[model samples]
Target chain A: MIIPYLELAISFLRVSLSAYGGGIAAISLIRHEVVVIRGWLSVEEFIRVVTLAEMTPGPLIVNTATFIGFRLAGVPGSLVATTAVLSPALLLLTALMLAARRLESRGQFRVRIQDAVKPAVLALMLMAIISFGRNAVTNLSTALIAALALAVLLVSRRKVHPVLVVIAGGIAGLFLL
Target chain B: MFVVFFRTGLLTFGGGYSILPVLHYELVDSRRWLSEQNYTDIVSKATAIPGAVSVNTAFLCGRVLRGKKGSATAVLGMAIPSVTTMILIAAYLFEYVHHPGVQRFMKGAAAAVAAQITYGVWLYARSAVRSVWVVLATAPLFAGAFFLGLHPLLLVATALVVGGPFVYRKAKLKAATSSPESEYSELME
Candidate 1:
């Protein structure tokens, strides 16, 4: 039991380190690793974990890690996995924050960092959209709803929130699906 | 303060994009600690770093508002609620989640989540894709990941290799043309 818990902690650490651009981007990688690579859980189980992570609070990565860990090795495993997934990011964040403060005093350094990061962030977001879209929009109803949601998001001036958009989609899904 | 932000983090659903309007309202419109421009700028920075945007936002906001202590409080607050909730749900999901109504609700929620994610991608693109180069780079980069099934890290690394030099050169040229004197002074300072 202890060995499995340790293994779960190490696996989650790897997943967290490799996952970029946060929860949504990490979802696929976690799914691949836990379900496909490690066989700790099946794909359906992975999806269920994702659903739970989304529905619950906190960041999705940590929530997912905890869920997977608990399933594999109970409560203690959950604690270990969650800590392992989070510690590296937190440490790196502290370092980066310190560096950013130092660099902010220098205009050229700040500008250079901004210039390099902007388009790269954009590219990463685009990748997230495509990857997630392929998986989520498997039918005509979902596709149409997604398109309408995009249009509403881009063009609407009512300041209609994304949550409301999601709610609307949910309503549409209930009626249509 | 930690409890406040932590509750906010846990309640937020759909993902980063979904949380933005809320964060805007809470921090800028309501709390007034963060300005609109500042919030947007921080969002960009959070996107660049590899983690959940909400957590990153919490950390930055906490640090800016109240320093290291504030940062710790905010991070813990934001993380705890969700962690607790997921654990509780995981414990009982197998027995309780199989109801037909619940399943139906989940299906609807999943579709909505997809839409929310798409909306976020579009919004980010609006800010990030100001130039022709960004427009040109986005599609193929996405294709390389989605169609080719290349890992996202590799795509990021490739984009850095291929696009980094050009962007750096452009920024340098802009600085050179705009105000070389000020740039040099600032660098020296």
Candidate 2:
């Protein structure tokens, strides 16, 4: 069990490098790792955690990793998972911080690199919405819940917090779902 | 500085790229701790880093505010809430989340979240779908992902190989024509 856990941690670390392209795009990669390959989480649980990450007050990837970690191996699991995702990133960031002052022409490269990633990010987002949408919108009740939530979000102009909207969806589920 | 990022972390629901406005308000508008250019530079560079974009942003902001310790402090402040919240959920709600009543809750929550994700993707599209070719290009990518279940890295690699040269050439053009001042100005708005 421990060995498998370590392997899982290593996999998480590997995934950290590919965590670029702004995060929503990374969701497809994460979903693939969690649900498709590892089978650590079912689609429903993964979706729940993604929403829960939104309700929590941190980065989505960090929250999702921590939550999934906790669900898998308890506190230690969460720690390992979070550390796996964060440590590589933090190290790389620290090195860049030290080096950035000397490096000229970073801004142009940054723009081009981001631009190069854009189409892929767009495609990944498409994959995430279609695949996750299929799993999430399993029935009419769920469909209505989604439509209502989208409407509420649209109507509110995003002034209403997403947490409130999600919690409200839970309440709506009590009767409707 | 730690207190600032701590507060930002607590306020950062839906974190990824969402923390930018909050950070901007705190650092540039409210406290004036950093200038507008400082904020823009931090954000653009941060997203390019390998970590969670928010964490990278927070860490760099902290580093800018103080030094190495500041970066560590900022990241710690940002992460504490997430770690604690997840632990509590694991210890308590893990079981109940799957209960019949809560399963219904989960269903609804999932739907709402999925809808929210759809809205987010649209926003990303507005920025990313620069040309009609991008739209045409996605069909094969979609089929690969949906039907063949190819890994995201493969698709991403494909996108890089296919789309990179055009954008890179455009960047060269901009570098030739425009001042560095104008490049970041687009982001300021």
Candidate 3:
């Protein structure tokens, strides 16, 4: 158990470190590792975890890591996995603080790096939506609900609380689906 | 600062960008730990880092406020509530999340989630792909991800290595040619 937990720790550390452009972009890498490579989770289960991540309040990566770690082992697994994923950010934060003062003048280089990564990140996000949409949008009612929800979010610019949207979607699902 | 970030973590919903409002209110508006200008700078810098945006924001703010220890405290405080909630869910309600009823709820919620993610697509595109050349270059990558079964990890890694320097050169050229009007001017305002 400890050995497997350590492996999980290592995997999450690698994933979190390589997860450029933030959590949403990281979802693809996670799916690749846990689903494609490790075979720890199926596509459906992975999508479900993605949903859980979205609904939760914390970081998507952390929430998904916790769930996967728990499913793999237990409480101890969860603790180890959480620590592993978070270690990079802590290390990076320290390095960033140390280097930030010296590197402050090179702001353009930093901005451009972010700019170059944006399109790829956007592509990954689109893939996530399409893949999940294909799975979730099975019937007419579900499709309508999805389109309506997309419209609502579009018009509102996601200002409305997400929990309300989830609740509303659930009620609609209960009645219609 | 620890208490403030803990509250921010506990109260925030939807994660990432959702914490922005709460952090702004407490750090900028209420406590005056950061001025509006400083807060904006923190946000931009946080976004530039990898990992979670909200957590990075907390970490950067903490470092700015105190030091390395402050960063650790802020991250821990922000993480505690969410981690506890997640672990509790895993312990008590894991099975139920996969039950028929809850799965149905997730089905609907998943659709909503998909919608929200679509909005993210546009949001990032607006910020990143301002030129036609970028769109043309990026469209193929998007298509490859969608159609050709290209892995996003590979795609993003390649983008970072290849595009990083390309964009840097472009920015430098643009800066050299254009007046020094300030790239961060919009953010400052």
Candidate 4:
């Protein structure tokens, strides 16, 4: 029991420390850790894990961590894994906040860097959309469902919450497509 | 403050920067806890860092708004929903999730997720510094990421280096911008 827990801690600590460019980008790194290194999950199982992560709330990386941890042990395993994944990040964040504070008098220096990199971040999001679209919208029927869902989201002035749209999409798929 | 982050975490279905619109709505538009500019600044920086972008945003925004305690509250609030929900799913739904009907339902959910993600990115792009140069950079980035398979990190580093002139020009114009923060001050502070 302790051995599994220890493995969980070490594996996810390594993941959090090394998985740069979070979310979908971390998927490959996570796959390497769980699938290749530990042989905890097969390739097919790993794909399911990622899909499950995508469907849930919160950070993709964290969701994946929780699921894998629970599978490894139980509820306690999940907590340990989540904490391990977050530990390194929290420390780094503290250091970063302090540095940002020291640069306070620099006058929009931080802001300018943000502006400079904003487009690249936008580009990354664009890639996420593209990659997600390819995986999710496979057939013409699924494509139509996605388009209608998008239409509802856009037409409602975004008054309709995305979760509702997703639920509707699921129901629509059950009967219609 | 905790409530704000809690709701954002609860609603961010696809995570990553999907929380962008939720945060904007909660912090910037509805409450005004953050200015429009400040939100984008936090978001952009969050994306570039090593940690989870949403968690990083929660921490930075919390630090800016209140203090360390605020950051603690915000990060905890941000984490709770995902941890509990995933745990529940793992214990119960993990077994049944592979069923055909459930899989179909999840598949449909994925389609809507793609659409919602499109909306999220659009919101951020609009609020970000919109300029011809940004527009110019976006197209090639898409091509490079798709065709050349460039890493997102590499792309961001390239953007920062290429956009180095902007930072340099501002420093030159200001006539004595702070020479990057010292390692000592960053640590000792």
Give the top-scoring candidate (TM-score): 4
- Over 4 Å off, model 1: A1-5, A31-39, A42-44, A103-111, A151-158, B1-4, B14-37, B161-189
lDDT digits (tens) for residues B1-189 of candidate 4: 998888778777777766666676678766788887778778887776665878888988998888889888988899899999999998788777678787788788778777877776777777774678788877777678889988777777887888767755764555444444543333333
Off by over 4 Å in 4: A1-3, A106-111, B171-189
> What is the TM-score ranking, best to worst?
4, 1, 3, 2
Model 2 CA lDDT for position A76? 83
For each candidate in turn, the TM-score is: 0.80, 0.67, 0.69, 0.86
lDDT per residue for candidate 1 within B68-152, as digits (tens), equals: 9987887788778776777788787556666666655556656666666665555445555668876677677666765787665
For DockQ, the strongest prediction is: 4
Docking class of 2: acceptable
Q: Clash pairs of candidate 4? A: none
lDDT of each: 0.69, 0.71, 0.69, 0.78
Comparing to the true complex, what docking class would candidate 4 get?
A: medium
TM-score, structure 4 vs. true: 0.86
RMSD of 4: 4.8
Worst 10 residues of 4 chain B by lDDT: B180-189
Error of 4 at B110 (Å): 1.4
What's the lDDT for candidate 3?
Answer: 0.69
What is the per-residue lDDT of model 3 for residues A42-154, given as tens digits with 9 covering 90 to 100?
A: 99989877777665667777777888888898877877777887778667766756674455465543344446655565566566567656766888888888788767755
